[model samples]
Target chain A: EAGVAQSPRYKIIEKRQSVAFWCNPISGHATLYWYQQILGQGPKLLIQFQNNGVVDDSQLPKDRFSAERLKGVDSTLKIQPAKLEDSAVYLCASSLFIGGAVKQQFFGPGTRLTVL
Target chain B: DQQVKQNSPSLSVQEGRISILNCDYTNSMFDYFLWYKKYPAEGPTFLISISSIKDKNEDGRFTVFLNKSAKHLSLHIVPSQPGDSAVYFCAAGGGTGTASKLTFGTGTRLQVTL
Candidate 1:
């Protein structure tokens, strides 16, 4: 079976530029999540989308960060006026959120963003 | 403040020996726990998990032990192999009775040497 897929595995941008990463989850997974993983640290949840609607985005920096999961299958995470601190690996994950507690989340090969 | 923490940044174990990686969480409400493994440039892959109601759960060579009172959990790999060397992350999930979004630990780099 195919795992979650993400685009532009690596990205480099200037501190003030805008960057976007895309993710395509496995078929039929309902819950989608975006996380930022800094070097030497764990991946922190930025936002979560259930179907086409958002569940949690409290950690998202709304002023510069944005994400949309249209049609409920694919998602895009955008960072505008990127700050140097935003340089990190952007990971996309999905899960079968329908049954039993929480199932294992399948992760995509993250997009490593480097903001210079 | 970090809710989940893996104090040891790395651990070295001899091949065929047992390797234990530990994690601690601050939230008492977390009801589900999981361990993930990741290689460089790849995303994390789920290893195993234990529900809050259970003190122990085992899967083949991997076992997860939870001590809810202490808010601590550990993952033990038996007869550790070089192929098992990777960064291990412990995550906690549970809330609102839905599939939980996870809160991950910093990660522990496990190296199995011959």
Candidate 2:
């Protein structure tokens, strides 16, 4: 089966500029997630979507970052006025949610954003 | 605050030897633990997982042991292969309404040499 798919494997933007990343999760997957991985650190959860509805986004910086999954299939994460500290890899993951049971999450290659 | 931590930043082992990576978590709410392996420029892939009820779980050459009292876990690879070289991350999740929300460790880089 095909795994999660992301676009623009790499991106470069100047500080204060805006950037967007796209993600298309595995077909039939009910849960989607966005994460940020800084150098030498593990991936940190940014937001989660359960069928186009947000499940969790407590860690997301609302002042600069936002994400949406309109159809529950594909998602987009956007950052406005990007800062140097925002330079990191953006990873998208999906999993099948069954009766609230924990499932393995399949990840995409990720989009590396470099803010200069 | 960092709930999960992999204190060892890196480890090197000769081929055909055993490799052990350790992880510690401070959150008592975590009841499910998972290990993921990642290569450079690639996203992490699920390797193995264990529930709190089980002290040990093994799949082929990879085994994960969880000690609830100590809030520590470990991954052991026997007869390690060169292909096993990658960054290993430990993740934890549990509690009501947060089973799917995982907290990950900083990761431990492991290299196998021949």
Candidate 3:
């Protein structure tokens, strides 16, 4: 089976620019997630969606970051007015929902964003 | 405040030896812990996991030990191979009133030499 898929594996933009990343999760998976991983650090959860509805986004930077999952399959994460500090890898993950919540998650090749 | 922490930035082990990576979490609510191995330019792959109710879980060459009272866990790989060299991350999850959200630690880079 194919794993989660992400677009534009690498991206470079100037500070204050807007950038977007896309993700297509595994078929039949009911949960999708977006995470940010700074160099030398683990991926941090940014937002999570279950069937086209947000399940959690408490760590999302509401002032600049936004995400959406359409039809419970594909997702997009956007960062407007990106800052140099935002230079990190954006990872997308998906998992099959079981017994009310997802267990193990399968990750995608992340999009590495660099803000100059 | 980081909830999960992998204190060792890197570790080196000779092939055929054992490689142990450690992790500690500050939150007591975490009941499920997982370890992921990642290679350069690729996404992390789940290695092994242990639930709080269990103290140890093993899969072939990899074993995970959980010490719930201390809020600590460790991943052990036996007969480490060259292909096992990668950054290993430990993640924790489980809480109330929320979907299971993972909190990961900074990774520990493992180097296995032949």
Candidate 4:
């Protein structure tokens, strides 16, 4: 089975530039997530989507970051006016939903964004 | 207030030895725990998991032991191989309303050398 897929394994941009990362989850997976992993730190949840509907995005910085899973299969995460602090790896993950039980999330290689 | 923590940043062990990595969580709401291994430039892959109801779970040469009362968990790799050298992350899940979101520790980098 193909694992979660992401585009542009590496990205570099200048501050104030807008950058977008794409993710295509595993087929038949119903839950998708976006996470930011800074150097030396664990990945932090940026947002979660349950079949095109947002399940949680409390940690997301809505002012500069936004994500959507319109078709619920592939998703995109965008950052506008990117700052140097935004330099980090953007990871996408997906998991199968069995009834109401949540399962292990499979992750993509991730896009390493470096804002200069 | 970090919810999950891996105090040791790195560990080195000779091949064929046992490698132990520790993790602690402050949130008692966590009902499920997991361990993930990651290689450089690759995303983390699930290694093993344990539910709150179980104190220990083993897969192949990897064993995870949980101590609920102490909010501590450890991952043990026996007869460690060089391929086992990677960053290991401890993650906790399940809370009152958190759903499937996982809280992860900083990670422990283990180097298994021959």
Candidate 3 Cα errors over 4 Å, as ranges: A99-101, B96-99
Q: Lowest-lDDT window of 10 residues in candidate 1 chain A?
A: A96-105
lDDT of 2 at A26: 93
TM-scores for all predictions: 0.97, 0.98, 0.97, 0.98
Winner by DockQ between candidate 3 and candidate 1: 1
Interface RMSD of every candidate?
1.8, 2.1, 2.6, 2.4
Chain B TM for prediction 2? 0.96
Computed on C-alphas against the true complex, the DockQ of each candidate is 0.72, 0.65, 0.62, 0.61
**Candidate 2 CAPRI-style tier:** medium
Tens-digit per-residue lDDT, B1-114, candidate 2: 999999999999999999999999999999888999999989999999888889999999999999999999999999899999999999998664334888999999999999
Candidate 1: give the clashing pairs: none
Give each model's whole-structure lDDT: 0.93, 0.93, 0.92, 0.93
Error of 1 at A99 (Å): 2.6
Candidate maximizing DockQ? 1
Across all candidates, the chain A TM-score values are 0.96, 0.97, 0.96, 0.98
Which runs of model 1 end up more than 4 angstroms from their true locations? A98-100, B96-99
lDDT of 2 at A12: 97
Model 1 DockQ class: medium
The model with the greater DockQ, 3 or 4, is 3
